[model samples]
Target: MMQVIYDPLLPWAAIWASAAGVVLIVALALWRRLPGWWLRGLAGAALLAALANPSLQDEAQTPLSDIVVLVVDESASQTLSDRAVQTARAIDEMERAIAGLENTELRVVSLGDAPGDEGTLLMTALSEAVAEEPRGRLAGAVLLTDGRLHDVDRAPDLPAPLHVLLTGHEDDWDRRLVVENAPAFAILDEEVTLTLRIEDQGQAPAGDGLVELDVAVDGGAVRQVRVPVGEDLTLPLTLTHGGTNVIQFTTPAAEGELTDRNNTAVVQINGVRDRLSVLLVSGEPHPGERTWRNLLKSDSSVDLVHFTILRPPEKQDGVPVSELSLIAFPTRELFLDKIDEFDLIIFDRYKRRGILPAIYFDNIRRYVEDGGAVLIAAGPDFASADSIYRTPLGQILPAAPTGRVIERGYLPELAPLGERHPVTAGLPDLAPPGAEGAPGWGRWFRQIDLDPRAGQVVMQGVGDRPLLVLDRVGEGRVALLGSDQAWLWSRGFEGGGPQLELLRRLAHWMMKEPELDEEALTATAEGQRMTVTRRTLADEVGELEITGPDGNVTTAPLQEVAPGRFQAEVTGPEIGLYRLSEGDQSAVIALGPAAPREFEETVASGAALEPVVARGRGGIVRLEDGVPSVRQVREGRPAAGRGWIGVTPRHAYVTSDVTVTPLVPAWLFLVLAAGLSLGAWMREGRR
Candidate 1:
């Protein structure tokens, strides 16, 4: 390139002032009718031009190649139907076409799924790619995608046009199940409403408008229901147990749908109990009776109904009934009518008194068998002739008292099975028996000798006798503590044991908390990585089987982390629900959102990028029609057409070298001025 430039020898203000003075002098001579005015003016102009030196510049230039960004969408949705193949073909054709164009290069940018379920960030990728190249050199951007981008707001201001090569057929359709609304927590045994909708996108086929929806909880039995499509359905669900409840809703894949990945949705609603209702019946007052009272009363969520049998019916102690401070026990209200209302019933040192009728005892037994919990803190009364074992309640008791009470200080130690039981496992950080033949916890002064009939012995006393036995009766649970001296631990006797922690676990376990289940399968996820855990009382667990979102099955060997806890980590390549099973235990956990943003809508369209493309005077062409030819066009003209897409030729260049030559030598201007001035003086003298 060549251009004329200036190098001023004086300030602009001084040059302008000197030119004004010369013009005034010429005007005065002209007014006076002098013959040398024009000559004098010419001399003055020559001298001023010398001060303002002008030069001709020529630049050595190199043309830079135009950068055409080929943003390829490799997100999860792009893999649906024939989109992947179409994308591949479009990329190949574009690469070849850009290579054919003179001084044009294709910059292929492969865009994958965004992290944390943000879906396909095609705009984000395009913006970044454009930022890496010079704005002046960017020919245009071509995106080969399904066009289901999630981050359209992040679109960058492009100096060049943007074209989209959409990659799906016009008739492509998809059916997806969407959970519009769901609660993160629901009250146990109460109904919670969930809003759901079924949507069909693209050219969907005609149907009955009713789809079969399958609903399952905790990966259990699936219940199917037919519901209308395109309308929100309110599902009323009641959580039966406490802890995390994984509810899965699935609609079977249609015949012509693009993919079945979105046919299922999972919702995790934590089940929480409103309150715990405990009935504490003390046959006689003892030091441990207050211990049970304090434990139950301390929990703000527990409603404790306690009654101490201070005066039995058989005792006629000459005391007036009105003068007595104790109120009569409501046997009919507690044991007969409202037995099912209480979550747990504790018989603390209770004997078979005539107070509760035989029918009442039978009702209590029935309560235990019908999803109710019972705990027996045995005293000497448990082994006496008046023992409750002789009553109808004895049928559900796991152990039978042997009519023997051993009175000796002995450490209450965990049995081998206790090391695996969730209630006793890793309790209070107590060490195992060492060379001193004693555990780290305190000791109890008395233990009732009992013959084990059923259930697992979790704790043992002197002579390896059963101190604590836990068993399940039908849907309910029962636990027996062979000694009432747990209060000794509460009093910090001989370095007290984990009295509070142990009782908490025992209570929660008997109440059927999911975390305290004897055998369970659970999983947690961080990004695409998953950790599967299996808790069982067995000596060893088998390999864990994992079912991924894509219905791919794989197995991972479980490593024993603790006595009965086994764990294994697996990578889930896709973001969706993962089902894990080990033996009979099964768990369903979502690696990300149950219905990921990618599969939320799988049909291909250019709506998201339409506004952006139009703003740049570009067009969208479907790959199904055919890959368009690439051509060069003017910057502001339309960059896409029916059969071709155009890239603007920037013709941008870099100046490698510069050369400047003065238009005229300064000495020439000086010589011309001197000659003009001499001529003007001779002409004036002659006049």
Candidate 2:
């Protein structure tokens, strides 16, 4: 390209001097009535033009290739129906067409599934690709996707037109199950509401018929029910255990459905106890009496019903029974009437005095065998002939006293069973200083020796005698603590131990906490990562079987991280539901959100990107018709036709070299001015 240039011989000051001379000459010609006045004025203008030099500039330019963005969607939704195949074909054809066009290049930007359930972010990907190139070189943007982008609000202001080559057939449709709202935590044994709906998108079925819906808790049996389509259904679900509860709802795929990925939904609700009612009966007041009361009362969630036998019926010091301040024991009300109302019944150092009848003890035993929990914090009284073990409750007790109570001080240590038992495992090592084992906690005096009749021995006292034993009778559970000196640890004797934690775990275990189950298989999900764990009393566990959302089964060997705890982890490629099983135990875990964004809407449509296309003067073309032919169009015009897509020609370039010279020489201008002045003077003289 050539342009004007200036090289002044005398600066702007000389232009002013020539202007004055021209004005004076023009005035003299007009005043003298000279016939050549016009010629004289023209001569003065020429002289002034010579003083102000001018030039022409010429440069060499090199053309720059236009940048055309081709965004390909590889998100999870794009794999539905024929969208993937359409995208592959469109990408190949577009690449070839851009390659054939002179001074044009294709910048391919492949977008994968958005992280953490965020759907296809086509606009975000396009903006990034455009940012990598110069704005002046951007020809236009072309996107190949299912048109279900999640981040359309992030679309960039395009320098050229933006077109969308939508994948999938125009008549594609999908039926999906949606859990509109679900509580993450629910009170155990209480009914909670789950809001769910079933809807059809795209070219849905013509009828408003009922669909078969199946619901299951944890991995239990599935219950099926017929539910009307396209309406929100409220489900009343009750939790059974105190821990994570996975409630899965699934609907059979309808005919002509796009994909089954959205046909099922998982809702993980944690079961929490509303209030734990504990019946605490203390046979006689002792140092540990306050300890037990303080521990139980410290927790606001526990409703404690405490009764202490201040005086036994056998004790009489010539005092009138009617004048006493104590109230009569409500044996019938507690042992028979509302026994099942309480979750756990605790007996602390009770001897078989004449206070209760044999029928009452029998009822207590029946309560234990019928899904009720019982805990015995035994004292020296258990070794006596009148011990409670000698009563009707003895049949359900895990151990029987040998009628010997050792009065010597001894350290309470965990037995082999306790090492693997969830109640005692991983407790703070309370071993005293210079002890053989870590956390050799404090010591206790006076241990009641007992022989195991049934169940497992979890703790030992003097001479390796059974100090703590746990057993199950029918559907209920029982635990016995042979010594009453746990209060020594509470009093900080020789440094305190994990007395509070130990008691808490024991209480929760007796109440059937799922985390404390002797044998269980469970999984936890955080984003796409899953941790599978197997808790068992056995020393070795088999491999853990995992079933992914895609129905693929894989087995992962569990490594013993603790005495009886085995665990392993796996990361999934996509977000959805998963199942875990090992031995006879199984569980279901829902990774990521309950309803992933990718499958929230599986039908393909152009509604999301229509506004963007209109702003860029671009058109939406369905890939079902075929990959549209590429054409070069002028800027600021329509860029799409029946079967063709247009890319605006930017005509962008780069400067290589440049040459500038004067348009006319100073000597030529000066000579022309002098000739005009001489001609004007001769004309005046001739006149």
Candidate 3:
């Protein structure tokens, strides 16, 4: 290329002044009718031209290839139906067409699913690709995707047009289950409402508009219900336990649906107890009686109804009953009428004294069998003939008193099984075992001798006898503390142990808190990494069987982290639900959102990218129709047509070399001006 440029021999101010003087002289000569006035003006003009030197510049140019960004979506949704095949074909065609163009290049960027539950980030990938190339050389951008991008708000400002080659059929359709609203925590045994809906997108076929929905809790049996589609369904659920409750809802996959990934959804709601109601019945007043009262009363959420047998019917102090200020115990109302309302019933050193009849004891046994918890904190009375074991409640008692009491100072020790039991697993850490110089926890001065009957012995006293036993009776639970000196620890006798913690775990475990279960499987997730935990009383566990979101099954070995706890960490996990099982224990956990953004809508559509494409003056074409021909178009013109897509030709180049040459020599211009001035002078002299 060649262009004329100025390289002034003198300052611009001097050049302009010389030109102005020449113009004024020419005008004066013309007005006075002077001879050869035009010749004198021409000579003056030549001298001014020499001062303003002009040069021609020639440039050697190299054409730079125009960059066309091709972002191919390989996200989860893009694999539905024939969209993957369509994307592959469109990319091949685009590469060839861009290559055939004279000075154009294709920059292919393959995009996958975003981390966590963040679906497809097509716009983010495109923006990054565009930034890698020079804006002046960017001709246009093309996307081969299903158009279900999740990050549309991050679209970049492109210097060229944007085109979309949608990759689904016109008749594509999908049915998805959507959970509109669900609470993260709900009160146990109380009805909580959840809002859900089933939607059909694209060209849905005609049907009865009713689908069967399957609902399950904690991986139990599933219940099916028929509900109408496209309408929100309010489901009322009551949690059974006080911990995480996994509720799964699924609908059968329909025929001709794009994908079934969205047919199932999971919701985890933690169950919490509104309040704890405990019934405390003390046979006689003792030092440990106040300990039970203080422990139960300390928690504001616990409602305690304590009744101590201060005056028995057999005791006659020869004083008038009316003179004694004591409220009579309501045995009938408490043990028969409203026993089910109380969550736990504690018998502290209680013995049969004709107060509660045999019928009341039988009713108490029935209550324990029907999912009610009972704890027996025995004293010397339990080893005597008046022991409650001789009553109907004895059937549910885990141990039988041997009619002996040991009154020697002894430090309680955890049994082997107690080290693995959740109730007593970590109690040893509170006060370490005694050494030669140091005594561990406070010593108990008395222990009731007992023979283990059915339950597991969790603690031992002097002579390796059962000090504490826990058992399961029917659907309920029972605990036996064979000593009444637990309060010694509360007094900080010697060195106190975990007195409060031990009682708290015992209570929660009897109430069937899921976290306190002896055998459990659970999982937690952070991004794509998952930690699987197995808690059991067994010495060891086998490898865990893990079923991923895509129905692929794999095995992971567990390593012992604690006495009874095992764990395994899984990396690079997919976003969705995972089912883990080892032996009879199974657990379901979600690594990301229950309904990932990718599968929320499976049918392909270009509505999300339409506005962006319009702003760039581009068009949306379906790959179902043949791959469009790539053509070169001018900027600010239509960049797409019925059977073809257009890219703007930037024609950008680089100037490798430049040469500058003066238009005329300064010496030649000076000589020409002198000759003209002399000619004009002679003419004037002759006149």
Ranking by lDDT: 3, 1, 2
Give a tens-digit lDDT track for model 3, residues 388-496.
9999999999999999999999888898899899988988788845622132677889999999999888888897789999999998999999999999888878777
Name the regions of candidate 2 deviating beyond 4 angstroms: 7-52, 99-102, 320-323, 428-438, 670-687
| Candidate 1 residue lDDT tens string, 1-687 | 999998989998898999999999999999999899999999999989998898999999999999999999998888788888898888889989999999999999998888888888888899889989999899899888988988899999888889999988899999988899999999999999999999999999998899999999987898999999999999999999787798999999898899888888889999999999999999888999988898888999899999988777777989987676467788899988999999999999999888998899999899989899999999999999999999998999999999999999998888999989999999737533432335677788999999999999999999889999999998899999999999987787767878878888888888888999989998887888988889999999899998887789999999999988999999887777888999999988987777788888888889888999998898899888899999999978888888998999999999999999999999999999999999999999997
TM-score per model over all chains: 0.96, 0.94, 0.95
Q: Candidate 1: list runs displaced more than 4 Å.
A: 428-438
**Which pairs clash in model 1?**
none
Query: Each prediction's Cα lDDT score?
Result: 0.90, 0.87, 0.90
Clashes (backbone N, CA, C under 3 Å), per candidate, total 0, 10, 0
- TM-score between model 2 and native: 0.94
Q: What is the C-alpha RMSD of each candidate to the true structure, in Å?
A: 2.2, 2.7, 2.3
Q: Which digits, one per residue and each the tens of the lDDT, describe model 2 over residues 1-687? A: 988877777878878887888888789879979988878888878777777778887889999999899998898888887777888889899989998888999999998887787778889999899999999999989988888888999999998989999988878889889998999899988999999999989988687578899998886899999999888999999888878888888898878989888888888888999999999999898998888899999999999999988777778798887776477889889988999999899999988778778888888899988888999999989999889998899999999999888998777888989899988887655444664433567778889889899988888878889998999899899999999989888887867667888888888888888888888988887888988889989989888888888888988899999998999988876677778898988888888854578888988889999999999889899999998888899988789999998899899889999888877888898888888889988998898
Model 2, CA-based lDDT: 0.87
Superposed Cα deviation of residue 549, candidate 2 (Å) = 1.4
- Of candidate 2, the 10-residue stretch with the lowest lDDT total is 429-438
